[model samples]
Target: MEIRLRVESAVRDEAEELTSALHDWLREDRDVGRHARIGRLADSGGAPSGAMSADWFGWVQLIAGSGFSTAGLVYAHNAFRASLPRRQQTVSVVIEHNGTRIVLEDASPESAARIAEILSGSGDDEEAPGGSS
Candidate 1:
């Protein structure tokens, strides 16, 4: 369960702030683990081989244990969004396991947070139908 958050295209100051916030959050939770800055796309000299400015836009990665459910992943995303400021910005989050990938995006952090919460079951806990927990 290695969680790595790599923030790219972020202004130096903003990136620093984001990194610090992530550290604090991860520290408070035992489920969350190590945080590392593998590399930054902006500092990669030129654009990545196949990543476009639009396609390879800024992103953050959370490497967690294998047993983590998708719901948990969604919860983490929502938590990250909640920590951000209210501003107009496009964000794309990709969670990769083995060779598979799950992507989530939003034009605004608030919307992303809402969607993540719904998917994560951290939102309204009302039962959905047939007495399913």
Candidate 2:
């Protein structure tokens, strides 16, 4: 599988930083192919400050194929949040595959696990995006 991650941020610098961090994690920890491409979506003036809104700012998309598994994407997101200070940071991750899109918001471990399960097709719940559990 070819997995591509695109991060969009109101802050171009922050988005770029996230892209770099994702690339490093995927490469070093997940053993992703060095050629796997991870990109940063240019800021288009629509990024939510305290919430995960794709309205104006930026978001990240991960596309993976044969050599990559959905689990890798989940792991990367978890790792990313783990490295950050929780009280000041919030991350929203969305995974799209085969027409199925699963979104996970907040920096909680449970959310990450839910995202993984959703992506893996083990989760049968259909909750609104960014909605409470």
Q: In model 2, what is the error at residue 126, expressed in angstroms?
A: 8.5
For candidate 1, write residues 51-113 as lDDT tens digits.
433423233344445554444444554676566776512333333333323334442444345
Q: When superposed on Cα atoms, how far off is each prediction in RMSD?
A: 9.9, 5.4
The TM-scores of all predictions, comma-separated, are 0.42, 0.52
Clashes of each: 3, 13
Q: Candidate 1 lDDT (Cα, whole model)? A: 0.41
Stretches of model 1 off by over 4 angstroms after superposition = 1-3, 30-63, 88-104, 107-133
Model 2: residues with Cα > 4 Å off, grouped in runs: 2-4, 31-72, 85-88, 121-133
Candidate 1 lowest-lDDT run of ten: 124-133
Hey, what RMSD does candidate 2 come out at? 5.4
Cα lDDT of model 2 by residue, 1-133, tens digit: 3223433345555655655665566656553434245544433445434434444324333444456655555666767767766642454445544444455555465766666666566654554344334
Model 2 lDDT vs. the true structure? 0.51
